[model samples]
Target: MASFVMKQMVGGKLNEMKGGLDSLTGGNEGEGEKTETGEDPEVVAARLEQEERRKDKHRKMEQEREKMRQGIRDKYNIQKKDESGGMGGFDMADGRIGAARKKTPEELAAEMHAEDDSLVGQLGLTEHVEKAKTAVNGAFEMVKGFLPFGK
Candidate 1:
């Protein structure tokens, strides 16, 4: 008996929620509140304006992101594939965005070699300096051992 009462209460609440949603959405499944045959001119204009604003926002964001990516590429000495004689090298200039191309194995290898050589030169010099310091320290210890001194 309690379960039956609970079910009826739940069903009534669900119906009320559905009615609220329908009212918010202009009540009809296939048509809005204006009419069955045509849309309001003002509503249409508003929707178009909204869409234009959305596109503008998206374009601005993409331009900002591209600028940051360009800066990073410049700092790392990464070559832009779009630098060839063609205007559409990496990104096309025709206002159409395209996916980035995957780099070739050879290109990857070359970049890796360049980066590795720089790292090796830096680290190798540091390691040699540390070894020289250790040798000096050891020589100082030997000299102190021979000195006639007391603590």
Candidate 2:
């Protein structure tokens, strides 16, 4: 039956594995002829090639990372300075740490509102439209105030 054929196949595979082990261990298991005591020349050469390839791959990766960092620095117009200096080098124009002055809260809010207004303008919503919406809401509140059960 199929079971008998499967068992035969498994036994053949086990014998092959045992023979390979015997050859690798200088035939101490008596399943194959003995090999030389010295290391296999082919295996040693393969290991040396693998080690050289790994070192080359790591060197390439480091080079690529440094290139990416340099590109980012160039794109942002950043200047590199020595870290041993007492005062860190900063781009004052870009507000990088050593800027002349900081903005007040009101200035910051104004800047945010300008950004919002620009976004609204981009979305086709004009300032007059916003004013009309406010007026409509105010009229609705005034009407509700006249009704006793408005609350």
Candidate 3:
């Protein structure tokens, strides 16, 4: 009878060990942590600030893109022709905005690559525009000097 009791206790101990090993090896990521959703206030505040900073940066980027697009439109003399344009947003144009045809994926991708700098809101464009204008104007002046008979 004593031997039988000892055998039962040994078997129970072995079962508990097996169960513990199984849990340690293969289980959900946060299986037994206390209060998984609970976070410190400081951590939450920091996270929020980080998110706001990210959003602000994104907004600034979006604004820069708008400025570049506007610059291009002004360069090409596009204007707002219609008061209403239903669903597709703005009835505006950089110049008589053409038909609303969408570009294929490949075409769009190519266009995007060309406009990469504009999207990133780079500062080099202002210098580029100024230099180009000066060069062209200087060339015109030189040509005018050569054409003394006309002026």
Best by TM-score: 1
Instruction: Identify the runs in model 1 with alpha carbons over 4 angstroms from their true place.
Output: 1-37, 83-151
For residues 27-132, what per-residue lDDT tens digits would candidate 2 score against the true structure?
7644343337455666677889999999999999999998998899999998766665524433355645665455779979898677665767678676767799
Query: What C-alpha lDDT do the candidate models reach, one value each?
Result: 0.77, 0.78, 0.74
Off by over 4 Å in 3: 1-36, 80-86, 89-151
Candidate numbers, best lDDT first, in rank order? 2, 1, 3
lDDT of 3 by residue, 1-151 (tens): 9999999999999999988887898845444543446765566788899999999999999999989978988999997454465336423343346445456799887985666568343654655676888999999988988897737
When 1 and 3 are scored with TM-score, the better candidate is: 1
Could you give the candidate ranking by TM-score, starting with the highest? 1, 3, 2
Model 3 pairs whose backbones collide: 78-94, 78-95
Candidate 1, residues 54-126, lDDT tens digits: the string is 9999999999998998999999988777556454545455555674555789989798567646755557665
Q: Candidate 1, 52: how far from true, in Å?
A: 0.5
Instruction: Please identify which of the two predictions, 2 or 3, would achieve the higher lDDT against the true structure.
Output: 2
Report the lDDT of model 2 for residue 99: 58
> In angstroms, how far off is 125's CA in candidate 2?
72
